[model samples]
Target: MAAKRILLLAGDFVEDYEIMVPFQMLTMVGHTVHAVSPGKAAGDQIATAIHDFEGHQTYTEKRGHNFTLNAAYADVKEADYDALLIPGGRAPEQLGTDASVLDLVRAFAAAGKPIAAVCHGPQLLAAAGVIAGRKISAYPACRAEVILAGADYATLPMDGAVTDGPFVTGPAWPAHPAWIAQFLTLLGTRIEP
Candidate 1:
């Protein structure tokens, strides 16, 4: 398979597994994954949050590992990458408000490049105004936002994933296996068993 250059959008309080797993897994499969966050440079770290469902009304948050970024956000050019990966977490709440981040998402969308967003990552897409008329699957709590953005919000199992045109989304981290698999396919990557 041809090596693809993937851009990952992340920020402080990003989900630990959501960012780390995809970064490592995609790189292991011969892709060059550059992870970046606004105002952060290479070697800069973002604190991650671990969300666990321990019979609570909502998932509980805990401090997670610090994730070292490999790329600087200011240095990224949308044309240099084959696809974009947006991981879900509290980060999206802030990332959605960045003009640069929204512009980046718009560039990927206009280019028809594959874009993968899991959990709250779609919040960025909504903020960028790119999901209109697309079918999206995100964390259940995001249903109203997804619908308000003019996308069809799909109610999916916790481990479910959905792909509509150039966009791929999942409910949350548990859907990573399927989410990544679908995205790899979109990137024209073949993993031989």
Candidate 2:
């Protein structure tokens, strides 16, 4: 099968495991992973550690995954990627509000490509006007937002992911693997490792 390019939108205070799990899982399955920040440089952003709540983990240091800013908020276009993966935490709150980011998101979903959002990541979908009438599951705090965006919100086992057409969402970090699994499956790729 052809390789798939997954775009990861990250920022300071992103959930550590939420981003890394999907990145590692997809890459191990032979997909190309590109991590980019709201800024226009290939650098590290601080992420909250799953095991160490007292410390912040740098993306490059923690995962050995150096980021390449292939497209910034001002430069991103949906036509450039095969799929989109948005991780949770405070990152999405900030990233979702950017006009350019929202435009890119709308383009991706409007074009019918796979789009996955975990935890607070769904907030971006709501903000981008892409979650209306779709079924999704995000962090508990996002229930109102998702519903207000016209999505059907449900509380699942919190360990599995849910896919709605080109849109996929999960509850939280524990569901990271499930989220990536659904995404890879939709992309016609196997989910191993």
Candidate 3:
């Protein structure tokens, strides 16, 4: 398959694994993944957060590596990319409120391009008003928001993923293998084992 240009939406406090794994995996498979964050420019970095389950009521958060942005959000042209990826973390909560981020997501949805959102990532999709009537999987706590956005939500195992048309979603980073594989299929990418 020809190399595909993929757009990755991220911000400060984005999930460490969610953002890094896919970015690295896609690049390894010959895809050009551009990581961008609103109000940030190329070479700028966003602090990442590591979320782990430790028998707590909710996941615990720890400081993670500072992820560098490869592109400037203000310069992104959604039409130039073949797919969109949104990683879950505290970033989406604020990114979802940004008009630019929402517009970027809407453009991808409008073009029928593949979109992958994991964990809290769907919050941005809901904010963009693109998940209505679609089926998706997200962090369990995001269930209400997903339903409120008119999407049918499913709770999947941590390592599971679901694909509905151009949308691929998963519960968390643990679902990376499945989530990313499904997305690559949608983007017409093939990787040999």
Candidate 4:
């Protein structure tokens, strides 16, 4: 399988598992994955948050590891990557409003690239106005935003994922197994045992 160059969007306080796991897994599978944050340079580290569901009305957040960027956001060009990844976390809440970030997301959508998002990552999609008319799954709290963006909100199990055309989405990190698998399929990545 040809290794695809993937661009991963990240920011301060991004979900720990959401960003870390996908970056590692995608790279492990022979894909060239570049994790980047706006106005950040390569080697700069961003803080991460660990979100857990422990019988609370909302998930609890804790400080997580620092994730370093392998690429510079200033150097990003939509055509450089074959796919886009947006991991859930508080970061999306902040990144969603960044005009540059939104524009990049829109470029990926216009190009019909394979895009994968988990949890609040869909927030970026909504803000970019790309998920409209598409079926998308995101963290429960983001359901309203999904609908507001004109996308059909997919009610999926925490471990479930859904794919609509060039997009693949999941509720949270727990759905990584399904989310990443579907994305791999979309990227034409064949994992032969």
Candidate 5:
């Protein structure tokens, strides 16, 4: 298959795992992943908001990841990509609503491309007016917003992500594996082991 180009969106305080895992996952399967953030520089890796089972807060190294100017949101032509993946965290709530992000989301959906959104990531879809009548799962805090946007919400295994038609969603960070698998399978690419 030709290179599968996928867009990964991020912003301030994004869950570190949510952003990294999917990027790693899709790349492992020979997909070209672009990490796009609203910041001028590649955004800093942030600490996870939730505590560990032992009650310790976890943090990540501040290594800079890829920034969006490389594929500036304003230039996200839908035909260039096979799909779009939005990893959830505070990022989507923060970045998803940005006019550029919203515009790309609408453009991707309108072009009939597949979209995978996790946690608060769906808010981008809602803001882009693309979630109406779709069944999705997201962080509990986003349930009301999803429904308000005309979607049916469901709770899924913290380890499992769900795919509905062209849209794929997962409840939280731990669901990255399922999120990645669903997208790759939908994209029909095999990971190069």
Candidate 6:
């Protein structure tokens, strides 16, 4: 299959595994993944956060590796990429409210591009008003938003991922294998070992 050019939305405090793993794994398989964030240019670095479940009501967050941006957010156009990836973390809480971010997401949705979002990443899709009638899984905390947006909140295991049409979603980083694999399917990426 031909390689897909994916635009990944990232920012300060994004989930460490959500961003890093997909970028690395997708690239390893010959996909072109562009990591970008608003107000940041190529070569700039954004701090990451590691969220772990240590038997708590919610996950605990700790400082994580600094991820360098390989593309400038200002230069991205939905027409240039075959798919969109949004990683969850504290970053989505803020990024979800950004007008430009929502617009870009809407564009991708309007064009029926494949979108893979994890955890709170669905927050962006909800805010963009594009998830209506879709079944999407996100961190449990985002259930209300998903439902309120006229979409079904997919209830799944921590390592589970769900694909509905061109959208693929999962609860957290643990769902990487399932989530990414499903996304690859949507991108028509075939990995033959």
Instruction: Output the TM-score of candidate 6.
Output: 0.99
**Per-residue lDDT of model 3, residues 14-104, tens digit only:** 9999999999999998999999999999999999999998898889999999999999988999889999999999999999889988988
Cα lDDT computed for each candidate against the true fold = 0.95, 0.77, 0.95, 0.97, 0.72, 0.96
Per-residue lDDT of model 5, residues 53-128, tens digit only:
2433432234334322234544456678888888766667777558877887888888878899887788778778
Model 2: residues with Cα > 4 Å off, grouped in runs? 44-75, 191-193
The ten-residue window of minimal lDDT in model 6 covers 90-99
Runs of candidate 3 exceeding 4 Å displacement: none
TM-scores for all predictions: 0.99, 0.84, 0.98, 0.99, 0.81, 0.99
Q: Pick the candidate with the highest lDDT.
A: 4
TM-score of 4: 0.99
Q: Tens digits of per-residue lDDT for model 4 on 1-193? A: 9999999998999999999999999999999999999989999999999999999999999999999999999999999999999999999989987999999999999999999999999999999999999999999999999999999999999999999999999999999999999999999999998
Error of 3 at 68 (Å): 0.6
Candidate 4's C-alpha lDDT? 0.97
- List residue ranges in candidate 6 displaced over 4 A: none
lDDT of 6 by residue, 1-193 (tens): 8998999998899999999999999999999999999999999999999999999999999999999999999999999999999999988888987899999999999999999999999999998899999999999999999999989999999999999988999999999999999999999989888
Q: What's the TM for model 2?
A: 0.84
Task: Write out the backbone clash pairs for model 3.
Answer: none
C-alpha lDDT (0 to 100) for residue 26 of candidate 4: 95
Query: Which candidate, 1 or 5, has the higher lDDT?
Result: 1
Residue 189 CA error for candidate 3 (Å)?
1.0
